[model samples]
Each structure stands twice: as C-alpha cells, then as structure tokens.
Target: MKSIVPCLWFSDDNCEAAVNYYVSIFPNSSIESMSYYPDEALDEHFIGKTNKVITAEFILNGQRLMALDGGPVFRFHEAVSFTIECEDQAEIDYYWEKLSHVPAAEQCGWVKDQFGLSWQIVPYNMGSLIQSDAQIQAMMAMKKIIITELENA
Candidate 1:
C-alpha cells in the first residue's frame, strides 16, 4: 500500500463516475483499480452500497487517490482542497473549465468540482503577482483567477 493516499468519500454511491470523471479531466491520469461491493451486503450499513463500487484507486497527475461509495454519513467541504500550480493563464483556464462545477462555491482561486471536492487553480507564483493590496482586492472580486488582471493590478 502507498504510504499515504487521499481517500475521497462519495456518499452518493457514485464512486465510479467520480473516478472516471477526474481521470478524464486530468492529464497523466488513469484508474488503477475498482472494487465492487458484494451482491449480498456483509453488513446492514452496506446495503445501500450493494452492487456499487466499494472503492476505486486511481492516479491523477501523478497523485494517488482513492474514492469510495461510502454512504451519506459524511461529505466534502471547503476546509481541505487540492492546489494546482498553473504555469500560465491557459493552464489555469483549462483546469477551471474542467473542474469548476459548483457556481456558488467559487471565490478567489477556489473552485468546487462535480464531486464537491475543492481545488485551488492558481499561477505558479501567486505571491509575487499579487503583492500589492490592489492586486489582492482584484483577486478577491473574481472567481476564476485572471493572471493578467492580477499582474496588471
């Protein structure tokens, strides 16, 4: 087993869809394996997961992650997120287009994906770009980060 892997919990029982969607969006990504729940659930709590995906292991942009159909006991929130260091506006835009799903959750450089996972799509050196208060204010006003605007500010 990998020393450490971020496991994603999907209370919706759509682990397969979430894994496939993420792999499709990210480059250098692939589904390593997917284990299905037994037809006859081993426990009463697993009844909802019967015939569904018990877990899926995958690699997204060289990062190993596991996703599971862990019924509605928990959910994804904004406290934890993945950060994508983009080299340019195009890279940021590409990831934004593919990952931003929840419109209301957008702020600064944070975006929520279809699976409710949060992601920070930003330039490689955002600190150097948004050094001034003006630039910080400019970034705060927008959802998808505009590198040019931040630099100009």
Candidate 2:
C-alpha cells in the first residue's frame, strides 16, 4: 500500500466503474483492491445499495489512487487537478483523447475528464520550454499543447 494516495469523490455510486475506466487508460495500472458496502451496514438511505462500491484502490501509471462512492453531498472541481507529463505530442494526444470530455475546459493543456476530474497534460520538459517568453505566449493560445510549436517559439 502507498503511504499516501489521492482519493477521488464519486457521487453517482460509480467508483468501481470509474477506477476501471482509469486503469484502462493508463499503462502499468491495476485495481489493488475494492471494498463494497455490506448488507448489514446498509441503512434506510442505502437499503437497496448494499453491494455498491464504497471504496476502490487502484494505480494509474504507477500513481496510487482511491475512489470513493461518497454519495451526492460533494463533487469534483477545478480547484484540484492531476498533471501528466508527456514525452511527446503523441503522448499528449493520447491522454487528451482519453481524458478530455468538456470542450470548454480545454485550456493550455488542462482538460476535464468524463468524471469531471481535471488533468493537465504537459510535455516532460514543459518547465524548461516555458522559460522562453515566446514559448509562454505560444502555450497561452493553445488548448492541447504542441511540443514542436513551443520548441520553435
């Protein structure tokens, strides 16, 4: 088990499905374990949802993460986001294709997945590339970043 892991909140009781979806997208990923609500633990509010997933532990590209079916009390927003460093444009495109769902959320390589989780798909050397003033301007105008454009800038 990881010392620390990010837990995603799913209000729709789809934690297991969401974890499986993420595992499918990234390499070196798998479900470590899953825990469901027990029948005896089900209260009146959760009478028919006894077997629903309460928590699921999974790994994505070596990063340990957890998903929780915490009910409809909370949701995900842009305040927190996961960043993926891509080695090339292909890598960027691959992640962007899989994770991006909201068209309007695509800004400067940041995208929101179907589950409303925000992610930033950036080149591995993004920090060094952004050192140049021109590159910064080039990046500002793009949704999904193009490594070649940043390099040329």
Candidate 3:
C-alpha cells in the first residue's frame, strides 16, 4: 500500500460521475471495485443506495485513485487541483478536452469541471522550468508556452 492516498469528496452522484469520466479519459484506467449499499438500507441517505459508491478504486496512467460517496460536506476548488504531467501537446489536449466540458470554468490552464473538481492540465516540462523562477514574468512565460504548445497541436 502507498503511504498516502487521495480521497476525493463529492456531493451526491458526483462521485459516480467523476469515476465514469476518469475511466473514459485514461486508456489504461478502469474501475477496480464498487461497493454499493445493501438492500436492507436502501431508503437511508446512502444505505442500500446504488448511487452511494462506498468505495471505488481505479487507475489513470498508472496512478491509483480512490473515490467514495463522501456526501456534501466538502467541495472542490482551484485551491486544490490535480496536475497532469504531459509529455506533449496531444496529451495536454486530451486532458483539456475531457476536463474543459464547462466553458465558464476555463482559465489559464485550469478548469473546474461540471462536478466542481479543479484540474490543471499542464505540460510536464513546464513545471521544472517554472520552478526555477517563481517570478511573475516566468510564470507568465510558462503559461504562454503551454498555450503555444496547445495551439500548435
């Protein structure tokens, strides 16, 4: 087992939505398991409800992700977003197209999906060069490069 794991929180059926979307986005990713509520507790908030995916495990490009029907207490925002390491613009485009389903949420290589989850679709090498200079100009340059790369693709 890995020392730590990522537990994504969702409101109602959003968890299911994310799981399905992720499976479709990554070629090697698939749902490993999904445990729903038993029949006896069907009427409860989540008990016996198929919508409540107790535990859903999947992998995206060799990265394992665990999702749950964690209810509406927490929400997703740009403060926390998943960074996809892409070798080329095609990979970035693939993620961008899949993630940018909502046009209003699109911003500087960042997007908030219909489910409220934030994702940063970026080129892998861009981060290394950006880290070398945390200045505003360097950040802008990196963003420009990413946009240029995506445009060229």
Candidate 4:
C-alpha cells in the first residue's frame, strides 16, 4: 500500500525548531531522520540556510510527519490543520496550552501554533457532544474544548 505522509512547511529557517518543539510536546515522539540543504546551493532563497534543515521526518504519538524549510514563499494556513482528539478536558487543555501561539486566530477549539500551523484541540466524542444547538453554541464560544460544559449545555 502507498502510505500517505503529512508534510509541514515551516517558513524560512524554523523547521528544525518546530520539529523539536513538537517532539518535546508529545510522548513517544522523536526525529526519525533529517537532511540539510546543500552548502553550495546557487539559489538565493536558500543561501543562508545551507546548514539549516531541508527536511526532517519525525513521529508524534506514533503518527509520522515530515517538515521542511521551504522558504517564505509558502506558509502553513488554516486550510490544512492537524486535529488532536482528546480523551478529556485535561488532555484538551494540555495540547491547547502547548500549541496555541496566535491569540487572534483562536476560535472554537482551533488555534495557530508558533510555527503558524493550525491545530484543532477537541474532545474525542465531539460528534456526540455537538448534537444539540446549545452544546454547539457552548463549543463555538470556547477557545479550548470543555467537556463538562458541553455536556451541561
């Protein structure tokens, strides 16, 4: 079977730092392999990044992911995001605390990290919890998912 590996594009030279941050946050996560840009590259875009990480493959909670320093021409946006399904409110808060960096972009359990990657920190039973309009409203008002509030709503 052809396996699909998700890739994250970090702006300019921050890919390695972002990969390290992610690995530190999750248990059982580590860098699988890394490759650097050619030291003698002719492209102006990669001039100072010769010693920087070109590609870094890593695992997050057993899920494999790849990241690269693809220059400032491209960036991570809300169009693509990683969703973390939390077992409880504590799990939700933990991931939220670790990933949330852009306060202005936060809404409805979704937040943008320092790397500008969007992440949805939500409850595992989100589908069941948002069945009612009240519950949905409660969730929509939250930056991080609150399980008990959703249940009470």
Q: Per-model C-alpha lDDT, please? A: 0.91, 0.91, 0.68, 0.91
Could you tell me how far off, in angstroms, the CA of residue 76 lies in candidate 4 after the best superposition?
1.0
TM-score of model 3 (CA atoms): 0.76
The true-versus-predicted C-alpha distance at residue 27 of model 1, in Å, is 1.0
Pairing residues by index, what is the TM-score of model 4? 0.94
- Give a tens-digit lDDT track for model 1, residues 112-136: 9988889999999999988999999
**Worst-scoring 10-residue span by lDDT in model 1:** 39-48
Tens-digit per-residue lDDT, 18-113, candidate 2: 898999999999999999887845467776568789999898999988899999899899999999999899999999999999999999999999
**C-alpha lDDT (0 to 100) for residue 80 of candidate 3:** 84
Task: Pull out the clashing pairs in model 3.
Answer: 41-47
Kindly list the per-residue Cα lDDT of model 3 for residues 10-86, writing each as its tens digit.
76656777898888887888887877655645556555465456678887767777887777677777788888777
| Total backbone clashes of candidate 1, pairs 3 or more residues apart or in separate chains | 0
- Residue 2 displacement in candidate 3 (angstroms): 3.8
Q: At residue 144, give the lDDT of candidate 4.
A: 76
Write one digit per residue (lDDT tens) for candidate 4, span 1-153.
678899888885899999999999999899999999987567776668778899999999999999988888898889998999998888998999999999998998999998899999988889999999999999889877889999999
Candidate 3: misplaced stretches above 4 Å? 40-43, 47-51, 128-153
Q: What is the RMSD, in Å, between candidate 2 and the native fold over all Cα?
A: 1.8
Q: List TM-score per model, in order.
A: 0.92, 0.93, 0.76, 0.94
